[model samples]
Target: MTSQSSLATEDTPPGGPENPGGGSGLQAGLKNRHLSMIAIGGVIGAGLFVGSGSGIAAAGPAILISYALVGAMVVLVMRMLGEMAAARPTSGSFSAYADQALGRWAGFSIGWLYWFFWVVVLAVEATAGAKILNGWIPGVPQWGWALIVMIVLTAVNLAAVGSYGEFEFWFAGIKVVAIGAFVIVGLLAVFGVLPGSDNPGNGFGHLTDSGGFFPEGPGAILTGVLMVVFSFMGSEIVTLAAGESEDPQKAVTRATNSVIWRIGIFYLGSIFVVLTLLPWNDASILKDGSYVAALNSIGIPHAGQVMDVIVLTAVLSCLNSGLYTASRMAFSLGQRGDAPKAFAKTTSRGVPRTAILGSVVFGFLAVWFNYQWPDTVFDFLLNSSGAVALFVWLVICFTQLKMRGIILREQPEKLVVKMWLFPYLTWATIAMISFVLVYMLTDDAGREQVLLSLLVAVLVVGVSFVRERVQRVR
Candidate 1:
């Protein structure tokens, strides 16, 4: 796979994706820190902040267990990805791993589905960001703001990958700092340190007071799991970033090694603070959002406005990452011949301009869809892309299992970040993903979203098969 291929050219490196450069875009100047924060920050989207409020409302404080369950699953998946990425670094990322370990078809299927998911996410975040912008500048229409935001991020990506990374770093940094402050203030309020946060059963009582853990029973926790998994979706960006970082191997190590702490700080820490501050069923928890409620309880002036700023930053960060990721996935597919060869070209600065443009065009269309058919088309987009996180994670597991054997047999030297307990942990994580999918099927609220996403997955698989059959006859 490394040294032999019909498509191989003189300029191609030993283990690199095809590099038909001086045609498309510039090189990514993102350093380790920029890349690292982008990786970490991507995981801390609005889902962790505002969306979790709904998840909490569903499961009460028991949602902590829900987050932990999803977090553990994510950690395992990242470790598997880290092992493969550490061994081989390419901008193609996990799709490359799938191609090498599974087959070209697996890579093509996952790449396109992941790309579709991001494009929809881009539109979703754009709408979300525009709402925030419109609130601040009422003179502008929401639709107009959405258009401007999309164009701005698209230009930033075309400018350079580092620009995207730098922007993401600051956006993510502000979110992290804001959440950290929320935790501190919430803790003070929970303990009745604040002047006005004195509720009937304050402090730790909130965790168990509302129906004594699992208020809505275990089923609600399962429902919360469906919502919580999306929060963990962004962590995989680290493996993607590793491909562009100065030290791909080190990037993987840092990404995987830090997974535990990320879960601890970002997921578990913030969540612990939330449950402590307010019961999951409180009306304010649903209406004002957990972070806002926490801030308000702490007597922070203009807490709602402060939280609005954080949420808006999160939306922009998600928007930037969505465009960057979709383009890279398409570029990887093109380089592998799963997509049009034109997408394989790179700019003088080493960027994939064609792929970037294609992704942005698709995103721009989705943005239009939000306005033109805000009622139905936007709903379909959301449903169709919602379940892709499971698909990507499952592919990662299968790819890891395949790659693990190949590495141990052919290149035992490349096992720095091995999955603990070898095949055991791998099997367990696969089971967890399967369970999530099955539970999703039974979940009335989340069922349609998963099924629609599966339909999109099936179409991608069918198309890849047809494409291969056509090539054979040609």
Candidate 2:
């Protein structure tokens, strides 16, 4: 374990982490079980269910390659982060690593970008979740449901880390079980094992016949990459949550070691089944999202309702994780003195109460946008964040590359969860992420949204940079 004294900088004192409600006897708030589940389910967001349809449409069955390609990048990036996180777990896992490896400016800029990313995400989740609920219960306006969702999740976040863990554990568990079950059933149908199955399983034929591997052409796959990368966004939640673990280092190692496989199987496996069982360009799936089509094709009764419920659960889970992520990132910033110190405050339950509540305000406003201006602000919010995902990922890669040597010099044994090929994979991942960013900027379908997102990301980065410069001069 890293010496507690070493953990403290000017921002964080030696005795405890930067807490909002002063130090509370909340026992670090979460245990191994909660950490494990949040680590698992936290990454499986609505993207798997909804956003995948667009990706498949763009690249056809060959979209699997897109997912695999991005997944490889994720594996390498997480491995890099895992090395640092396992050495010294802290609330600001990646940011802290960036600070140690790069400089105060790098951490300050990236950390704020990450925090901004999730605050926007908080709104997106609420709006997405509220849409499903609003349809079911018309009397409750969509905006009203959004408010309810944010307030409720905010309450969960404020309750305590243990409670947050418990909530996320179950939320993530439901998704794992549902998607896992979907994969098993889909596989049976693929092998012609499902009872009374009349429809012919197309298997690998769907992957090629629809558009062939390069159906939309090599150029289209790049467009597909723009959408596909967003689905992989939540996988790093494990690293962030690991900071609160009782044994932070071990938890970081275990979570990072396990996440690559989990994300690969769940995401790639499910998408494979979807494309194999039904063509990528299938009308029903394209019009209504892939999950709906997969469920309905398998002869699941009330596929729409079933998927609506599943997606609703996903939205809530994402919202829950969004609030948690944003709060922690803010808390990290505050503790590091990168932001106002008030954000570092923790409640009696060791929860970052102010940050949690403050983050949800965006969620509420997002809900309002979804209800009153769905076509304008809400859609822009939805599309804008897709590019920012790439930005956050790129920063992680650079931070890791710079920090690896410092970490090894300080604590060599922490390399147990290290990325294979060391700097090679790290640099490769950086190149891959950079390619995705450039591709997003070029893709016709994603051009406006990506451009706008890039602008927002730059503004945030620039502000953070200037703030640091001023501080240094002072």
Candidate 3:
């Protein structure tokens, strides 16, 4: 076992110093371009494509506010995470930081919770991707498509880290380009610069013209927050993926620095274009996707089909990253003695075969449950993991608060990417997360998601505490 001092050293990976067990057998196989694209595209997922529609329906143009709110929260959390990650550059990422700053139980609990979250995400992304594939080829069943996708991506992850990075690079490239094009074209149309954008609604009027900004009420902004918050879940994939990059510290710092623009342009910018180009009340935005509906409004032919392809890419990217992340987290747990040591074992290729297979096994079962009892099993899985992003963000905030003081006192030179405003903004971000959680409980639509997530969190915590007590007795 490695000491905490060894784990805290720079220029090494997750396990400890540059020793036999260091990095837990993971390799720094990802290239610069792969790191760049993962940094840019990591946050852009199928959620923005499919789920934003519902958020728009719930909060109308005010949904933009929802995106901004969650985007700010994510930016703050990522900044905090970036500070620690740049310093230590752990594959465990937040869990490792939590262990250093909080306790072993914090690391164990959050690590397992994060693993659970992503394993379920694998099933969700696989199912979502399968639907798009099945639509294109009706001969293949949805379950078959889901299985194929999971298997292919699983192979990519197991083959090597570079393969996963290459695949995600392209997947995220398509998404980034698609959204960037949408923003440019939609902005042109909004300003009546596009040739066929002579329609009366082709301006900023739709934002307020459609029952005002808060169509439902001011409460709907919070509702929109709840609806859109989950869309921002995948942003942390960059930090996790950075662990396998050639320069983990540089990768984390670069990714952290660029997060603000990514969220602004890809999320808020694109959504702004959609609201301006089409009325928020339009059925197609929800019936179809917000982006597709906006494209269709501007006479873009086969817009829905085009978007379906991009959404598929996003889904596949999510599944690929999910497997990589969960396996890495499991491997970290093993390294820290929080998980079975077998998971710390890896193939010659530096792939955590045991960890990856364990995560995939649960993913396949979730996909099976999704097919067998779509409503009950899948819904429960979805809700149980729904609020984990928020939970993770909360932990990041607190961990940064404690870790910041330590960094400043013990390792002042390690402060590469510091959080703005020190503890002030950090406290504000925490309060904001608390408000969202409390808001979730009050809102009937989000209450179940919050409750189920809390149950899973409590269960993990309980298990962590039990394990700690047993170890002490032993």
What C-alpha RMSD separates each model from the true structure?
2.6, 3.1, 2.2
User: How much lDDT does candidate 1 score?
Assistant: 0.80
Candidate 1: segments with Cα more than 4 A from true spot: 1-18, 24-28, 193-201
Residues 1-474 of candidate 1: C-alpha lDDT, one tens digit per residue: 321221232123323443654353324367889878876776788878878888888888888899999988988998898888787666667787787777767888898999999999898889988988999998999989999999998999888778888898899899888877766767777777755654432879888877988888888888889888887777887766666667777877887888888787888889888788776777887889887876655567888898889999999988888888888888777777878877777766667788989998989899999989987998898898998999999999998999888778876886788888878999999999999998999887579988999998999999988887897799
lDDT of 3 by residue, 1-474 (tens): 222632543346633333244333777889979989988998897888888889899899999888998999999999999998887787788888888788877888899999999999999889889998999998999999999999999899989888999998898899999999999988888888788664454468898987998888887888888888888887888887777788888988999999999999999999999899888999998888888888888888888889888888888888988999999899878777788877777777678888999999999999999999989988999899988889999999988998888778877898899999988999999999999999889987689989999999999999988987897799
TM-score of each: 0.94, 0.92, 0.95
Question: Highest TM-score: which candidate?
Answer: 3
| Clashing pairs in model 3, backbone N/Cα/C closer than 3 A | none
Candidate 2, run of 10 with poorest lDDT: 1-10
lDDT for each candidate structure:
0.80, 0.76, 0.86
TM-score of 1: 0.94
Q: How close is candidate 2 to the true structure, as a TM-score?
A: 0.92
Model 3 Cα shift for residue 324 (angstroms): 0.9
Question: Residue 399, candidate 1: how far off, in angstroms?
Answer: 0.7
